[model samples]
Target: MSYLKFDKTVMINLEESLTREVLRTNRKGAYHCTTVVDCNTRKYHGLLVMPVPAIDDDNHVLLSSMDETVIQHGAEFNLGLHKYQGNNFSPKGHKYIREYSSETVPRTVYRVGGVIFSKEKVFSLYENRIMIKYTLEDAHSATTLRFRPFLAFRSVKSLTQANGNVNQSFEEVTNGIKTCMYPGYPELYMQFNKKVKFVYEPNWYFGIEYPKEQERGYPYQEDLYVPGYFEVPIKKGESIIFSAGDSAVTTTRLKSLYEQEVDARTPRTSFFNCLKNSAQQFYFRPKEDDAYLLAGYPWFKVRARDLFVALPGCTLSIDDPVRFEKIMSTAVPALRAFMSQNSLDPVIRELEHPDVPLWAIWAIQQYAKAVGVEKARELYADFVHEILEYISGQKHPDMKLMDNGLLFANGRDKAITWMNSTINGKPVVSRSGYIVEFNSLWYNALCFYTELVGGAPVEKYDKIIKALDKSFPETFINGYNYLFDSVSGSTVDWSVRPNMIFAVALTYSPLTRMQKRSVLDIVTKELLTPKGLRSLSPKSGGYKPYYVGPQYERDLAYHQGTAWPWLLGAYLEAYLRVFGKGGVPFAERMLISMEEEMSLHCIGTIPELFDGNPPFTGRGAISFAMNVAAILRVVDLLKMYNAE
Candidate 1:
């Protein structure tokens, strides 16, 4: 992506530590954040979490701490510390969502440490004071970092410690002042919520009160907005650290942390530093052997195979290939586990529960193909055996749904479409009954298995693929243009959507050029957005703009109308097929720009999703493996394009 098209205020560099950046968005969606860094601990720190002090209407500070467990909110009202109390079941979004505005403050303190040289960050919580510490030492000297964010009481202030509650409301606390000293290092770390607004108040204005203050060595630092730099004042082999959270003190003791720097000590060190710190903020548990670090976070967990759709962009390109294997291998057992539980159709891996749509399998096979053969042979064998079993059950001699060409999933409501199936209350199989995307997934999986294995009649799979190809265009044809959303004879849903793209991105089984063009034309005209292809049309009743909010509402916002960045991979693949690939081509430019913009969020990693609007902001997953996996595939494609 060229600098011109990629230009958008030069935003923070993906390569620099959060501490080294000039400005970052603070919690509550604010636009300004000034940070400080402690080079010894390698842990970053922050002050004034956000503009407006992150006091939401709910009367709670959203402690969106990724690594630390306790969010030590500095209390105001001059009555000392007043803790809000309430209990809210986190949808696991707690692993990622920094509800810097939750109504209650858990009595437990939040503490997360950043490892300057490790792969993961430590997050823990306690009461009263929150401290995060990291230590690393070589033969010469040991480097230890400890950050303590504590409650500060003003001199002669009349106040008492209050009870903590979760349902507490937001209240403005003082723009506190507290000074932490590391004899050797002074580049204190600071991390305010990036979603909030902040301005660096002058450091000189706050350094008062403490009589022994003017004796320390001068703190070397830089003013980060433009070209500036800051240095950690540690011995060549020693380290220093900083503690975060809104520490309380009268405005007199606020430390000087306003500085930034570009250029890295080592690409690998800087790279790992960012991931290590961010990791402290979220949870991604891989079942011992997954291809990606983790495709699951907070709530919306997906299948292991689904993660491959975005792998190469993850560890393959930038990280070690061996680590990538750990991620890929995880799918083997994941699939087996998913299939083993149910006997009705062993091949069906319940995509969470009740029904296993073929689309996920579609993506998995594609991922395997992308990974190449030797690395995926066992995966293929298991996949085929199960698929062949499924085919045996479903292919009623005539090769159709159940005993005929009807549309339904294993006796469920006929609307077994991927868009609208509900199981145990959770909306499963949404937009049901012979949905085009589902069938596309179905048809492609069949053809792919047939191509790989030498068991069933290859012609049988070929014929089905051909049949679906011909049937789709005609059955879905809408006279003037565009294909139907599904062929259960259901109406087109009257909403502009990008479900049709699957027919284009899928391999083997089908889609004619004109049909592809038609589908592409419809989507380009309606579904394309700055972030990604919108799932449902705004004109549709179900669409909802994504915003920070309560859980259910947020989940509803997801996919219902939210933009999915992962879809950009699908879109890019489709674009490559339609316009031919290569960065030289104009289409490739769009793709590259898309990649550049995405990489900016995590220094080259794709976000899970983005806002479904212009200036479409990437949201949720920071450094999510699945999303990055998709971008990696795109990168691979770009390379392939270049080779061609």
Candidate 2:
């Protein structure tokens, strides 16, 4: 049985069903998301969401949802649910849901009286389109299905209002109708494979509330426009395909187009198979022939730091070196100009993060391990050299080469590092100094570059390594035995954080065997949870056990003490490195919850984080790509250890 399949019990419970969401994505950047019961509780939930490059860079919710109704024997059953102002849910469509499964593409089975029908959603692998195929499983009598399409032509971050700006007009195509709500948006096509009657009654749907947005203290109420309904008859043992796309389709070939998409998908039989499939959803090939991994669903776009951090597991776990090369090339255009710009921030955001270059080098090293050093050099040597030279110069204050041969990143006013949560225009956790992970990654990058190509003066590189080896451990180690999180001008932020794991886990470390062991022991004792390591140990005064409430509270607790599942990969690496083969069973035990997680929350994918407290509840972004990659890495590491 598929673990993601929800039975009648889960489907009937409104509270439970609302909490569990399903996601489907096309490799070209379009996606479909909604609650298990087909009710949208969050502002991000939509039937079709995709980016419109001509209008704006961000994603827009062109088609919010399609409410379906079944009619038989002059009786009507509404199979759609909607939440309005004052916490009222209309129609209660989930009552008719027999089962909902995301095992393949999102499939929902509904039984309305003697008539049984199933709805399966599939996204085109190469285009911004979604097709929902409805099949009548059993019918005692003739039936009709009415589909009302709700349109929200606005950015995903904002809500829509019933304004005069909306163009309430539509044009008829072959077997579809094309409509554009306003200017600066793509024309949306709602089509079907067979003949269907379209009733043109356009009106605004007002007072719709999104609970998740209300909880986040944002404007939660919005109005969506409905472009009438389509009346399509249902025949026993027959299926009809409903297509929605940015551009008009060849309506006659709709079934063939959907069939091709379904046939192209890889079979997902096991939990790991589902995870591997979900991991593939993150990889999108944009116009430049460059493949980029989205950080997470709904909100996050591709970031320079997140791309590298997620690359190793995404590519190496699947043994796709060509994909690794494709993703790596996406960073080249900006990185090649880093030296001239005197800054390494490749993303459009104004913030400067020093960890981007560090993670990039680490990803390169991982690529080398996967496809050998020779192939890796042929692919990444020039890019790596350019990045190294850029970092080798005097740049931002938080990320600079110090006289003591250590890389110092002291982002005083700006939280430039990964602990980049700011509240009230100030950092929540101010970790600005010669951080442990920064130096370790810097050292690793330098060593990898030197090994790859030795054009740099050997004496200068050697001198820096010798000085770092002499000073890193001596200055950072506190009495409790782990390295300080950061140190700036005699002031040491001595909190135990997961960042120190990189000090031992990286290809080149600045720690001895004994020190590595000490660091691992401290981390395991205070920070290691079943899911991952906490951002801060409980011993620290700044620890926040729960990640809850609005934006400010969540941001303050984001890195304060929240347990990040992605950090588990690094901790497992350091644990295995220090303990060798003996750590395999324990590492395996730590990952057993992942199998359980496959059935919960966002089915078949790991959450971005969990609460710091016991019974660490999954929080933050659901279906996070980095978290999935981290788990894949640990699985690979354990397999290697067992082989040895």
Best by TM-score: 2
Candidate 2 backbone collisions, by pair: 398-409, 398-410
Candidate 2 lDDT over 36-123, as tens digits, reads 8888888888999999888777889999999999999889899989899777998888899999887677789999988899999898
Model number with the top lDDT: 2
Q: What is the C-alpha RMSD of each candidate to the true structure, in Å?
A: 15.4, 2.1
- Candidate 2 positional error at 631, Å: 1.1
After TM-score superposition, the amount by which residue 13's alpha carbon in candidate 2 deviates from its true location, in angstroms, is 0.9
What candidate 2 gets wrong by more than 4 Å, as runs, is 343-351, 395-397, 453-457
Cα lDDT over the full model 1: 0.39
lDDT score, candidate 1, position 416: 34
Each prediction's total of clashing residue pairs, residues at least 3 apart in sequence or on different chains, is: 80, 2
Per residue, candidate 1 scores C-alpha lDDT tens digits across 1-644 of 11111121221221232212111221122111111111110011122222222222111111212222212122111101111113112212112211111011111111122212211121112101122222232223322221222211111111112223211212233331223221221111333211112222222111112111111111212111101111121222232222344333222222222111112111212323233222222222322222223342221233333444434455454444554455445544554454555333221123333224254355456545566544455555566557545544553221245323223333234333334434456662245445566566666677767655643556655565566666656665677576566444444445566777877877743577877878787777767776677776676677775734544555567666767656766777787787774323654555554545422543423456776766666665444545555555665677678887
How do the predictions measure up, each by TM-score? 0.56, 0.96
